[model samples]
Target: MTDSFQKRLNFDGNIDEVIERAANNYSLGNLKHSELMTVGLQDYNLHIITNQGEYVIKVFSKLRNVENIRRYVEIIKAALNAGVHHPSMLKDMKGEFIHTDEPSGLSMIVLEYIRGKTFYDMDRAPNSKELKLIAAETVKINKIKFKPSYLFDSWAVPNIHWMYKQVNKFLDDEGKNLAKTALSWYEALPIKLLPTCFVQGDIIKTNVVLGENSQIYIIDFAVSNIYPRVQELAVMSSNLMDNKKAPLLRRVERVKQAYLAAGGELTEVELKSLYNYAVCAVAMEFMGSYHERYVIGETADEISYWMQLGRQGLKEGLGEK
Candidate 1:
């Protein structure tokens, strides 16, 4: 979680009132039950069970710019058109997807509640069949036609260098060395030569929901944007290749093959950069976690899990095992 989100969690304001006002915009009967979700890191997700139906009200944090939020909504529309399975956002009374609360100075959007298990909830990696479906959906997502915006997300793969620079000063000696090596590998890749597309930059376990009938639904488009096309594979492989019985390279090959089977085209440059990008993805995650813990004053225990994953991933990427 980022510093802004931490502050939002501690906010003493009446959030129920905010939820009530936001729900008033939609004719969803009356709010019967509402629960604050603990999964997302960027926004305040309130699960509301109204008299009509269940829905999720996502209140944007202060870190989210309104323009970027609009872009996110647009991306979700594009993803749906491209045959990606995900929750749909509902328009308010004014037929607008986003609603801003004047009293709290917060922007929010309501999406249909998806009843399923996330990979986080399941506590397991996607099985072979699930991985193939996820890859196919990712291909569809990459093929969606959307205009690029100047939205800046620190977690984006293309911004790995910049993120390293920002978080370098806060790392200890071991972390500094690990990040430097990973950055070197990232910099050596022919980044400009690779293809670019709108990617779901953060496709970790929590953002993916496994619905009924073996359907896979992707949620949380907060960090989705234009980037090197291979980044989609890189992000997915790094997070999903958790099978202890398989070699790392073999696991990555499974991801690549599934992607290719789904009609995803990859250039030679993209193939070469895939491993490097995956490694750097882990490194970037580490830096972000470090930034939260050291720079943002979050407890080391809060971020220790990510730090351990980062260190282990960097070693695996560097063939230190």
Candidate 2:
């Protein structure tokens, strides 16, 4: 097994024991078979097959703040009511979505297993139709009015400056130059004047799953927060436009048009700043992944992938392509 997989398996206690305790909190019948999903870097996701049905138990890292998890749950509930196709959070025996295992001091939540394949699982870019569906769903999420009390998220687009500061020193000279260019464009945007809303901040391919009947489900709201609404399209653009087979500008326009059709209104300032924000989003991912790989010692190959995309996004945004 690769080091990345080993890192994912490196939990504190017995895996079966932890699953049993967490599953006991739910009314889901006996856990027939459970497998650790090697998906995300931060959380330990278990694809558990219960006699009642299928469900996902997300065991959050100790580093995650409980308050943030609570806020994420609230945002998800609101998003669901607004017709966003997100997996339903399952309430535990105590009528709460978050269940704390007293022994491990780890917080876990059960969600209805989305029966589909994430773009990551397919290892391909979302097609134009899928991109439009993603844009429409994002509009539904941004339309949510309930804002969490905590609005400061390191991964939010507005915080790119802060993230840049944290990761620039670790970046090489070429990486630094690309990041600086993206930052310069980001700095020129009228961020304060742009419309703000609760955005599904991370709209990357991995967080989007193509479900049965072509329904698209957005998962993993760990980075969602209130931000300039345009950041939604920006994040989507950065991820979707990475495909070299299609013209980047065409993909960008498609998502923008879809968002507008789905009741999203972008101001003139936001329109001009969209590309800049998308580039900054790429820089953020690059730097953040660099930090994880170099500083935190994560051996995931995704760091190099982000670096490659960051180079492309920065050059394209600067008209250097």
Candidate 3:
């Protein structure tokens, strides 16, 4: 493993300086430094504490191009205004997403930090009844009446094919083979079998926070886009599979039933393709692991566990019978 990675926190200053910049952007007073907690990626993550309160500063790696940051902020804003629960809020100091005159040559976005433990821990799964509630809330979010921003008409655009290219380009021979296998599996599946909608894209335990007042908040819309509901479901199911006691397949079925009960529309083809989507999703994680984890190094997340869960979902999603 590369001992030293081009990680975050190249600020070249102490938290006090960061607070100065933040205060200027948010138009706040001098912020005292609080203990910064590291989560998600490798660096650029700090939980600053001032006399006022706590806020999260997530410095984006160059991987997050200008367009990507802009689209994410805009989408999250839309989701919030549309009555969808999400992290605190974010605003771009500059006009939309533009090239920051930074040496890194990447655009940076600032969001109000929302604090909470990641929901991905194995113990985070709700009881049987609570799962139903989670499903209902998810359906309600999907039903939120709203329109997508014109800036990104094609949210899921760089399609799976493009994703494959990304995987192949970075991975070694073994990784490339994994990517190819994943590609063929997804290609073999009929798109018509999967229901379509705006998937949470990168739904994982950490992304969903169980907030105070018994509220559930889903944050991080960077990977979000309009895609097959099954695709999203598969990915979510795989996420839930971290618990060995609670098999991911069972959770998926329960979530599906709950989603349907909560007004999630599903067709025969869509329902059937759910399994395929799950399996293919696992392959995707495996193939993309290089770029996401190894190549990106510490900056990337650990999505390796989801690979097996996704494969398991393939069979379970196909049909329990």
Model 3: pairs clashing at backbone N, Cα or C within 3 Å: 32-50, 34-49, 120-205, 193-269, 193-270, 275-317
- Winner by lDDT: 1
Lowest-scoring 10 consecutive residues by lDDT in candidate 1?
A: 1-10
| Residue range 1-321, candidate 1, lDDT tens digits | 333443654455778888899889876679898887767565788889988999999887766787778888888888888889989889999999999888877788999998888886786779889998988888888888886576777777778878888889888898899888888888888988999987887777778899876789988877787889878788777766554445456667888999999999999988887877888887877787777677666553436766776677776766732
Question: Of models 2 and 3, which has the larger lDDT?
Answer: 2
lDDT of each: 0.79, 0.77, 0.56
Off by over 4 Å in 2: 1-11
Writing each residue's lDDT as its tens digit, candidate 2 over 17-91 gives 878887788888898999877766667788999889999988876556878778768878888889899888898
lDDT of 3 by residue, 216-311 (tens): 667666666666677666766666434545555676676678778877887888676665566566555554544455454444324454444444
User: 90 in model 3: Cα distance from truth in Å?
Assistant: 5.7
Colliding pairs, model 2: none
* Pick by TM-score: 2 or 3, better one: 2
Please, what is the TM-score per model? 0.92, 0.91, 0.74
Candidate 3's TM-score: 0.74
